[model samples]
Target chain A: MTLKKWIKTPKGYVAIAMFAFLIIAAIGYKDSHGIKNAFTAVFAGVIVDIILNIIKRRKWTLPEGAVITGLIIALILSTATSILVVGATAVFAILSKHFLVYKKKPIFNPAAFGLLFSFLFFKTGQSWWGAFGDLSVWTILFLLVGGYMVANRIHKFPQVFSFLGTTFVMLALMGYFNIGDAVDALRPPFINGTLFFAFFMLTDPPTSPAKDKDQVIFGFLTAAAGTLVYAAFGGLIYLFIGLCLGNLYTYLKKRSVSKSMVNRKGFISTHR
Target chain B: MVKMDKKWVILCSTAVAAAYTSGFYSTETQAVKMESAQHNQISLHTKVQQSGTTGNIANYALNQQNKKAKQKYKDGTFTGSGMNRRGDIQVAVTLRKDKIVDVQISNWGMHYSESDVVDLPGQVIQRQSANVGIVSGATYSTEAFTDAVQDAINQAQNS
Candidate 1:
């Protein structure tokens, strides 16, 4: 599809917003490394996603999802990270979307899964720069407004609210009890990162729930699990782990509902 | 029976969470600021006492002698820890003949690569001082490293 037509779609609009975010974030950095890292990640994401699509469908396809994934990874990672590492992380993210599947759908957010892998293996630092975290505190207003628009447009406000609410409550409790390092998440960059993740990654339609109640549960589960991980291990990967676990819950829930539907159909047919 | 909409639930939860978090964060930050301020005042008071009156010249000479004497290490390896917002960093400093022979970073909890601050330890040994140039990309890591080295030097002086 042409760029003009694509922009009219929800996904294309989101892609354009993400690109705008990338440009804004890149300007905050001291040097050209920010743009370089973003470029490398996006380039790698596009190439790998195209290859994977060709392999799966035996035809060329424009990979919007891959581009978004790349931009996210670039934004999250430290601007000081090597270009090669950025590219490798993008490839890994795209690879997860292609390989880790359940019922022809990915069982996890590809970007989250890939970022978790990078944290474990590469020890890459995540500054969450793409959320405009490095800039002045007023930039949070931009994140909030943009995120609200996206969530509202996608009708994922419940999911975003539940996740953010649960997270803040958990952080407050942790701070009150002096439980763990999780309380540091209340600060900037981390707060911005959490907001970014909720708006962009958690609201992923296919991996999350549709119904309002289910969406609330999904958000609550994700925040609770991620907070627990932070309490235990106190690492940056907790957010990613939480999102992946929530994805697993969604997958299982979907499977059970489909199974029951099949059984009900079989029962009626047999009775007839 | 009246049923609340999902939107109400979301709005309520968000408000409560925000208020609770802000309350806790405010108290914690205030406490930290107060504690640091007191610490700074105490250090400043000590500095004023050390440089006060005609005794300043005598004190300066004595302080220099004491500093030179205290700078000498007893020749062994010591480990020290420095903690920041990110996490703790532990470093081991090896000393010989009243000079630092080697400094090794044993563990760090920062997000940036270790390679970013790898040159720091070498600089410490060359200068025989923990006040090394900060790494371009790893400001926090460098601060933590220097603090850890300073902690090790303190241990060496006490030993």
Candidate 2:
């Protein structure tokens, strides 16, 4: 697609928004490491995506999805994380798309899967420092604007609705039941970063359910699983884990109906 | 009731199992972090206090206050906890009569290099209430710290 054509695509729009988030994060954090981490992730992700595509005999392509994935990982992971871990995660994330396949496409959200793997192997902290959490309350306005645009453009409002609704409702239940001190998570960084995830990551086109009904179910289940994860285990990886499981559920649901239901081209999507 | 997808059912079941297992793990990890936080404060305050008493920083502070003034409030240390971004934060307040003589930030589970909580204890001590003072730019940690200090103060006031 031409730059003009790509700019109009849903992924293109989201990519712009994601980059805007990076700029906002850089400004809000006012730290050189976050900016460097963002570049490292983007560079690593793009390089890996190119190398993998060439090795697989695919055409040379602009790896926008990989860039988005790298940016998300950089933004979400702790800015204090070693640059080596950041670069490794971006590479692993791109590799996950190539290796962890469902009908030759990645099964989980690449960033989520990559971050989860990094967490297990590296024990790297996920500060979600991209949310500008420690900065002004005004930061939320940017998230809200970007979130609304992307969610609206993709017609994934129901998924966002269901996920946030179910997660907060579950959180409310935890509060009522006094379930293992999860209420404190409703505060700034955790809550803000989680909302950003729901709006951006959980709505990935290939992995998430398309229909409104399925999306509602998908969102609720994701939230329920995440809440369970958060309340029980207590870590920063709950959102990523929830999305990974939700993706698995969607894949299984489609596979159960018919093998032909999924599009092969969707997996090979160079733009998205 | 609508018939749910079989795959969904299985996934939900798996989620429940995962949650159950993780809950246990979280509790254990939190306990370990709490134990270590006690150790960090010891290393931190040894030179700051010059007394070399690590385990009972709050108690030692209370004793120092006792030497200078007749006991005004209940003579004991109190502890309270609240949630932070990464984990829970706990504050121990030392009291003599009605005055908050000293405060020890007992446990904070965050591994993030946060300098904000350092100012929070002093604010609570000076203000005599968790109702006052918030370190700017550290909104969530400050809120949690204030809550923890308030919890300790309330215990001291009541006792």
Candidate 3:
């Protein structure tokens, strides 16, 4: 289909809205830092998308989801990070969406994968930007507003809440242990970068678990894994590692379900 | 129109390549700065005399000096407290020696947990140079812990 026809679809509208909102928000805040980072992110996404499409013999067009994800990640990361790292991460994200799975199905959240890859190999650091300058009051208000909006739209309130609640309780236990003031130090993870990842990145429809029960399981497991890694390593990269594991688990479970369905259909056909 | 003129594809790719190159070069320079900072270390020592009548004052001075030195250096420190490590409060203070250094508690009870606020010592040394920051989150523990360390320093000075 032509770009015009593609833009008329529901997914297209969502993508467009996300893209426009991100750009406008970047502008509205008059955040020169965010705006500059956003530009590099979008540019990187567009470039990567075009290259991938070309390789696959498809017509090149910007994927709105990729752009929005890049913008959000940029907003959440520290300005101390160079634009080059941001752009490299965006490219990795788009490429992972296209190439990191069998057939056409994505086996990982592209943003999560890219962030983890950047953390490990690129040594890119993240700062909590969505918390509105790391101001506690602003962080809380933003979480309430942003969390509610995301929960309502995605119908994943239970998953998000359970993940946050469970993680908070676990960290509180660490605080009880006096493990480097885990509870107070842990505020940044919940309110800062990972909040955006939880509400937006991990909850991507195409990449996340489909069933409600499975999603709850996915959420808790992701949080638990993240908490464990953070406790062990004391770094920011483990959050992405946890989410990636959740994505892998979801993929495996989906494959098993498909296999079972096929077996059932074959049994009925043979019996009949 | 003739497959929408594929010429723009080449131009776009070139532009992206240029942007990537510029970004990479600039970041490589910053990465060097970060590496240098990581390896940088600072060390300083200050002496305080204790009045024979009140050794607490000298201990307080030494603790304050250590914190101030760490802050001045903007580097981490390594400090230890308590006699023979079997005390209600044994702490380690790591300092670069011009500012308040990172503080670690080697031993403390559950009651002491609240008082072991890290930022308090760091901030106190930063602001007052010789005073401790208010352990807003954990008051009693901070006082007991800071005073105990101060006492150790006073003994060192008296000796």
Candidate 4:
């Protein structure tokens, strides 16, 4: 389909609306310390999308994935980071979306993978400004609105709920144990960094499991693993690692199911 | 039919097992890198010194003299060195009394080049200012550089 056709789809509209909200929210929050950093993020997002789309040559359209991911990256990075790093991160996100997949299924959440790559290799920070900001309330509102729209489209509410609830419970227990001030630090992941990631990044359809049962398992595992990593590492990298692990499990499960089905069909045909 | 499906189940389970093993290996590899990165970014080469006194009266007099010098200079520079598996960092920091003035950092170590860490010192210096903000995406490096600079400042003050 042409880029225009793709943009006209329901998913397209959701993407556009989310991008608009990000731009507006970013501009509104510009007065906050290092608000100007959003420009670099937006710029990086756009440039990376453009380049990737050109390479793919599928009717040049704005990459909603890159835009949202870039905004999230920008929001998380400390205000002191240079714009160049933000742009590089955007490029990494898009590239991961394109490159890190097997059997036509993506192996990781593009944005999360990008952020992880930056953290591990590029030494980029993920401050998650949305987690601690003056306009945190507004940020939460934006997430809720965007999240409802995206979740409604995919009918993945169970997955979302399981992930969020499991993560909260795990962290709460960890906090109760007084493991490194876990309880005091335990807050709604939905409020800030976790919300943005869970709502947008984790919900990517291609990379995530499709079956409802599988999704429930996948989401819970993702959250549980992420919390464990956070406890061990005491940073945001654990979040991405958790998601990536979940993706790997889902991918393998899907492949196994399909392979078995293929084998069954072949055996039945040969017998008949 | 049920008997045959058992084989399929076994195959699927085997795939899962293989994938789990691969995932574990990858995670292990990534974890090593993460740990090394964190180590490379922090330093513990710190020193502390205090000025010698001629007498009680002399100590007071020296304190006054140092205070004037500090006021007039309004800035002083500090330098320190540290190493990790990745490489070594020699950090220079300039401070205006309690405020940071400027920072110059040089690194000699590791598979990663100094250019990878050059901006780190500046980030540390900038964020040290009262009006400074956190560097975008460069959090660990900033911390590493800042820690080194703090060590240097402590050394200078003691001297």
**iRMSD of all candidate structures:** 5.5, 10.7, 21.0, 14.7
Q: Which ten residues in a row have the lowest lDDT in candidate 3 chain A?
A: A180-189
- For all the predictions, what are the DockQ values? 0.21, 0.07, 0.03, 0.08
Proportion of native contacts in model 2? 0.04
For A1-272, candidate 1 gives per-residue lDDT tens digits of: 78799886667767877888877776766556777887899899999888778778845657788888888888888787788888999999889888887777787898898888887777776878888766788888777777766776677877878888888888777767767754457766577888899988998776788788998899999999998988777767789999999999998998899999999999999999
Ranking by lDDT: 1, 2, 4, 3
Candidate 1 collision pairs: none
User: Could you give the fnat of all candidates in order?
Assistant: 0.16, 0.04, 0.00, 0.12
- Which of the two candidates, 2 or 4, achieves a greater DockQ against the reference? 4
lDDT of 2 by residue, A18-123 (tens): 8887788777777778778889999999999998898999977778899889889998877767788899999988888998777777788999999999877876
Instruction: Give lDDT tens digits, candidate 1, residues B4-110.
Output: 36677567656856754674564476447644744554454355336442211224335657787553355799886665555557899987766788889998765
Model 3: CA > 4 A from native: A1-31, A58-62, A179-181, A185-190, B1-159
Off by over 4 Å in 4: A1-10, A31-62, A130-139, A181-185, A188-191, B1-63, B66-159
Write candidate 3's Cα lDDT for A174-266 as tens digits.
655545334323443333555666666666767776556777798888878887877665555666888888888888888898899999999
Tell me the TM-score of chain B in each candidate: 0.61, 0.51, 0.35, 0.42
Candidate 1 positional error at A204, Å:
1.9
Model 2 misplaced stretches (Cα beyond 4 Å): A259-272, B1-84, B89-159
Query: How many residue pairs clash in each candidate at the backbone level?
Result: 0, 5, 25, 13
Candidate 2 docking category? incorrect
Q: Model 1, residue A244: displacement in angstroms?
A: 1.0
Q: Judged by lDDT against the true structure, how good is candidate 4? A: 0.59
Against the true structure, what is each candidate's TM-score?
0.80, 0.66, 0.59, 0.61
lDDT of 2 by residue, B12-115 (tens): 43554354344434444444565476455434434433634223324544785868754334668989775544555788988765567788888875533245
Write model 4 residue lDDT over A1-272, tens digit each, in one string: 78798666645655665555556555655734444555666677777668766777758654566666666676666666677777777678777877777874568877788778877767765555544333545456776676656765665655676677676666555644544324212333323667667776677787887667777798899998988887765544667898999988987887898899999999999999
- Candidate models: Cα lDDT each: 0.76, 0.72, 0.56, 0.59
